[model samples]
Target: MMIEDVKLSIRHRAQRNYERQFDERNRVQTDGIVTLGRLTIESPNKNMGSEYVPSPGRLIEHAFAHLPPDLREYTFIDVGSGKGRILLHAALHDFKQIIGVEFAAELHAISKQNIAAFSAANKHHPPISGVLGDAIDFIIPDGKCVFFFYNPFGRPVMERVLENIAASYRQEPRKIYFMFLSLKHERGNDADANRELLERQAYLRPLKSWNANRGAWIKLQFGSHKLTMYETADAGNPIKRRQRGANGAAASHLE
Candidate 1:
């Protein structure tokens, strides 16, 4: 066989072995995605964010390691959860609740199946549930939340989702940590929309932008999908007060 063929075979074997270890049985490839027009929750016309890819287990582990120990109580939510791959790995930890939201009904069903299988094997984990709907309309849980997004949707949907999340904070006044993966950021895309929305909103603070190149987890040569973390500002934090005051000033100046 040719050297190139040997390399391709090795790559396939590595990917399959990775899946075998990380519960990637539920169609991790992007072959069956509908790309023509808007499909149910995904916007193929306006934003065009539809492709199925599982989050790397090593990246997730590194990200979670940065979070505070108390955040283990926060409900873990994967926005645009494809097949519950992240949920299965998250269950390996001790989160309070685990949830996956997928727009496609078929994907949602598969997520349910994955969760069921994972739960059956690891019976000591927390509660896990998968929701089927557009993430824009999905209600945020009424407490601290750990939201994960892997370039799920385009700008329009991301803006709406952030609006919903911000509104939840407005009503309940609690902490929210956003862990965004693969943030190259372009206008009208998921990463850009999320960054713009968060910047425009006054309640949250962008905390860290980790260097994915320096990352030791997963393959050394993964994509440049940097994991950025953001959290809601606490009432007493100086930055929060200043942000609120600046927002008030901006509103007053507009009048």
Candidate 2:
């Protein structure tokens, strides 16, 4: 077998092992990928949506590790949250609240059940719940929030979602962090397109520092893919496209 293929095989095996343990330890059913054809929800942008794949637990933790030291003031939201795996993982943190937005009725139901199971297991975790509706229709709560995405939908839908967030910011300016993990998919190019669209947002900028390493650039690995982080920029100092920055580049490498 080719070297990359072999490496991929090993990664898949490792992911399976981790997930099996995760499900057992948490006593929740949050594994497996449900293809688009299998999803039962209907929406105008249904064709723009990607299949349901739970974000890896390790990846989720790595992304959260880079957030501010104290998360008590922030709310954690997983857009297009499938089966609430990420939501369950978010509960381990100190966020004020945890929310999973899902459009699929079948997957949404499963996510609610998973939340119930997780709440039963851990009594002191943050308040976590599932919201069943189209992502664009889900109102952004007026508070400091860390919105997360795992290649949920196409660029068009993502643009709409970003606009919604931007609108919310306009009304009530607050701290907002966007955490996006680009998954390696077997079909379609939504991941790449979504990442590019995120970079193009003028009101958003890539988060440069991570963990305790000041000024250090980091992209936590998920096999060959990486999780990119962005935060709201001062609306007055919007980043223009292809504008040379401090490093004398059109944009930061992360952007």
The lDDT, on a scale of 0 to 1, for candidate 2 is 0.80
- TM-scores for all candidates: the values are 0.74, 0.84
Residue 254 lDDT in candidate 2: 26
Query: What ranges in model 2 sit over 4 Å off?
Result: 1-6, 184-187, 210-221, 234-255
Over 1-255, each residue of candidate 1 has an lDDT whose tens digit, in order, gives 996576556545655576665654533332233442434545333245556667655567767776667656689899888777888767767788988888777677777877777766665988889988778767899777889888787777787788788667766777778887763433455566566666665666676544333444333324334567777777333223223364456431210
State the C-alpha lDDT per candidate: 0.67, 0.80
Taking all chains together, the TM-score of candidate 1 against the true structure is 0.74
**Who wins the TM-score comparison?**
2
Q: Which residue window of length 10 is worst by lDDT in model 1? A: 235-244
Model 2 poorest ten-residue lDDT run: 211-220
For each candidate in turn, give its C-alpha RMSD to the true structure in angstroms: 5.6, 5.2
